[model samples]
Target: MTRHFSETEVVAILDDLNPARLRSFVAARVVTPLQTPQGQAFSEADLARLQLLCDLSEVYDLPDDALAMVMSLIDQLNTARGDMRALIQAVATEPDEVRGRIMTHVRSIRVTGRG
Candidate 1:
């Protein structure tokens, strides 16, 4: 089962996560914790993200807009990495001839506008 952290627990774990800052993070959609009847329950991922947000806010002194942009770029990079991994796996499944052809096509595309 996944472990969940209450607001107090989150604050305890991350000293920088004050109530006001937590509210701001929620408003900014930076960390979407699960809402229970008790209160907001954060997952491990949420906690990690919150820690990063804290670092960005305190250390980098990034404003909300700038932080959002940085996070967006990070998300995009992660997505691209996953896509590249899947593509590599798919390529690995192909025959040697097919792989060679694909490499040639890729090289040609890099050298010229068209493959």
Candidate 2:
């Protein structure tokens, strides 16, 4: 059977987050923890994501707005990755010399102050 995490377990996992920030995340509905009449519960994914958020917010010192921007960028990157997967399916192989030539040209352009 699959396992979900409890709120306390989630809290314990993300020891870097302040209670106030955690509560704010709850209030923001960034993660929808399961809740009973007594209290809220969480999934393992929620715990993991909370830990990641704490790392960004505490260790990286990102403000809430900056975190939101980072999340938006991540979503965009995920979508781009999906698109890239589909595009790569059609490619046979990239020639190494061709790739190296493009890189060399790009470097030469940069050195010569050209776009």
Candidate 3:
């Protein structure tokens, strides 16, 4: 099972992320945590993201709007990568003839720069 960190524990791990900054991240929709009756709990993914956010904030000095845009783009790219993996797996199951056709079409598109 994946480990979950409480709000306090997250702050402890990331010293730079004080309570207020963590709250700001949540408010900005950058690092979302799970809400439970006890309180908020962050998963490993959230922890990694929060760490990245802290690094970006400290190292790059990015403005709030710019940071949000960067994070949003990263999220989109991750989603696209997952979709690409699924598509590749689906294509892998095709018969050799079908796969050959797909390869031909793909190579044609690449060479001609058209679909």
Q: Write the per-residue lDDT of candidate 3 for residues 1-115, one digit (tens) a residue.
A: 9899999999999877899989999988898899989899999999899989999999999866778999999999999999999999999999999999999999999999999
lDDT of 2 at 81: 99
Among these predictions, the greatest lDDT belongs to: 3
Residue pairs with clashing backbones, model 2: none
| Candidate 3 error regions (>4 Å) | none
lDDT of 1 by residue, 1-115 (tens): 9999998899889988898888888888877999999989999998999999999999989987787888888889999999999999999999999999999999999999785
Candidate 1, residue 61: how far the Cα is off, in Å? 0.9
lDDT of 3 at 67: 82
Evaluate all candidate structures by whole-model CA lDDT and list the values in order.
Answer: 0.91, 0.71, 0.92
On lDDT, who's better, 2 or 3? 3
* TM-scores of all candidate predictions against the true structure: 0.90, 0.58, 0.92
List runs of model 2 lying over 4 Å from the truth.
34-39, 90-115
Candidate 2, 1-115: lDDT as tens digits:
5466656666666667656777777775556787767577777767776777777777788877777677668768989999989766534266778667767887999999885
Q: After aligning candidate 3 to the native by TM-score, how far in Å is the CA of 67 from where it should be?
A: 1.5
Task: Report the lDDT of model 2 for residue 57.
Answer: 77
lDDT rank order: 3, 1, 2
